[model samples]
Target: MFGPEGPSLRELAVQALSSVEHGYDLLAPKFDRTPFRTSGRVLDAVARALAPLGPFDDGLDLCCGTGAGVRVLAGLCRRAAVGVDFSAGMLDVARHQVRAADGPAIGWVRGDARALPFTAAFDLVVSFGAFGHFLPRELPGLFARVHSVLRPGGRFAFPLPAPAPASDPLFWTLLGFDAVMRVRNALWWPRFVMYYRTFRLGTVSAELARAGFTTELRALPEFGRRADGSPRVRLVVATKPTTQQGS
Candidate 1:
């Protein structure tokens, strides 16, 4: 249990045994109370980093679980802010939880991220803390879908923490957790595809480039630097170029 209101062990086990969508659906109500939700620190840091580039008219929060990142989108976009996710339960919770107090008119849509139901519609898009559900092989298609939904010169942004060093205990913990997940999925019926170590920046950058994004990494200075002086976390700002190659 993470806190007084967090899901109990039995609830977590039941959800974990279910498919990814179902699991999230079951967790929707208590998701913010759990550690799985993106932290306010990260959201605030991202909002600050993105503010200069925005005054954007339209924005999308991809895989917008319970609408955490929608709060960030609302701050930057002027006219419309949309949150899209496949889990109807999650969207239902989001609809009630988030309100358009200011910034932009907010809306929630139920849809799959791999096959998003929009094209060149948004000037900006962001996702937070949901990449682990996607496998390494899915990056190309996922990035392509994000690209397709963005208007020319639109930006797809997300925060990526630096991988824990090999000597760090967190590194081994994630490695072991991923191993356990592999074994569990092998033995289970509905596989829960959440692996923390699969999305490496090198592979992700290459995939984004392949999907027609020009990628840039902006330091999230609020999180500070590591021992090596590299940023503890960096925001990946991958843009869909305004001009076509042949044009």
Candidate 2:
């Protein structure tokens, strides 16, 4: 699903063999051209979903590769929007690619998601298509970092796609992808940690609660529904409570 402007197969092989940071650095230049980039449709849908709850002041885009999520923040946040990631190369492209002349001021920082550099600095935080890099066991610490960066009553929001049913080809596709990743990590160093099946809604909600966020899910109707009337995707909005008793 890569375009001509995307990385070559050889280039992708090199990246897959490298550490996550170095791999992203090598892929950063052509990232937006690849399917790895968060789709504009998804971004627009998220922006629409988040608009009612916001008029937010400052926003942060955690694990913001190429700053696609920052564009959403610029529309919803009034003051400033900052994108943070570990890849300097991605930030470099973001610096040159993402700009808002009249909206919120955009800035980029090189940092890890596990240990963010800010404390209660953001009123809203959003991430897109980056969670697979983190293993299930890491969710607690990662959510805690997001919680620490957000002011009380602030939100950490992201779109969560519904899992494919067993009858669907995508189900097998993702299952196989995760299996390959597991095998590869078992046999390789500097593990490239991308898995499709590990992040489940129940587990994520529990972790967010442990991190002091009251979690809720809003259906994104644009993606329509399954035969069972379940939403195809949802926006997970986890808010840090305003008071000790969870308000």
Candidate 3:
């Protein structure tokens, strides 16, 4: 359901076939217009939730696409903020989109998420809507890399919506989409790994714990409850142990 400003059908086809980095690079210019970019509502809500935990000195936005998540970092962080992504095209748009005074000074870097280039240089690290680019097996390296970049007592936070059950139509929609993705990747080269269903809560929570984090799931009340009364949105706040060794 991309809006009129989102990528065209031909554009989507090209991105789907390319490697994740190249795909994002091709889509970056129009990314903010797509459903892929983090929403302003979600970002503001996360900023509010994060405010209590911070007064952060420096921040990093991991896999920062178009820098929407960096704006949240800017709210809590005082000094400098950085955004890293493999896609240079994404960084270019992020550079132009999110600039404000009384906020953290934003800088962009081109880098892979699985092998971050910095060490213990940040008080906060955040990502939005980019986890799907990583396969389940890749979470260990990716999370470890995020952990490495964070200073003692620093956090790596992101939002995770509660999943729809099998009975729900949305669940089937997502399942079908993921199945299609699997088929496409099986038949193609430069596979795009983005899929919503693969990032389930229990598995992810375990991975976060394995990556040396004390994790918490904070319910987002603003998004309201599901039919079963579970919060529709949640913030996964995973903190690197304050005593973690610095590089």
TM-score result, candidate 3:
0.95
Candidate of highest lDDT: 2
Could you give candidate 1's per-residue lDDT for residues 1-247 as a string of tens digits?
A: 3997999999999998999999999999898899889999999999999999877999999999999999888889999999999998899999998899956999988999999999799999999988999999899999999999999999999999999999999999999999989999999979999999998999999999999999999999999998999999999999999998679
Q: Is candidate 2 or candidate 3 better by lDDT?
A: 2
Evaluate model 3: give its lDDT: 0.89
List clashing residue pairs in candidate 2. Answer: none
Clash count, one per candidate: 0, 0, 0
How do the predictions measure up, each by TM-score?
Answer: 0.98, 0.98, 0.95
Q: Give per-residue CA lDDT, model 2, range 75-168, as digits (tens).
A: 9999999999999999999999998799988989999999999989999999998999999999999999999999989999999999999999
Off by over 4 Å in 3: 244-247
Which digits, one per residue and each the tens of the lDDT, describe model 3 over residues 1-247?
7888889999999999998889989999998888877888999989999999988999999899898888878878999889999999999999898886877788889999888889789999998888888899998888888888888789999999999878989999989999999999999998988898888889889998998999999998889998998889999999988775573
Models sorted by lDDT, best on top: 2, 1, 3
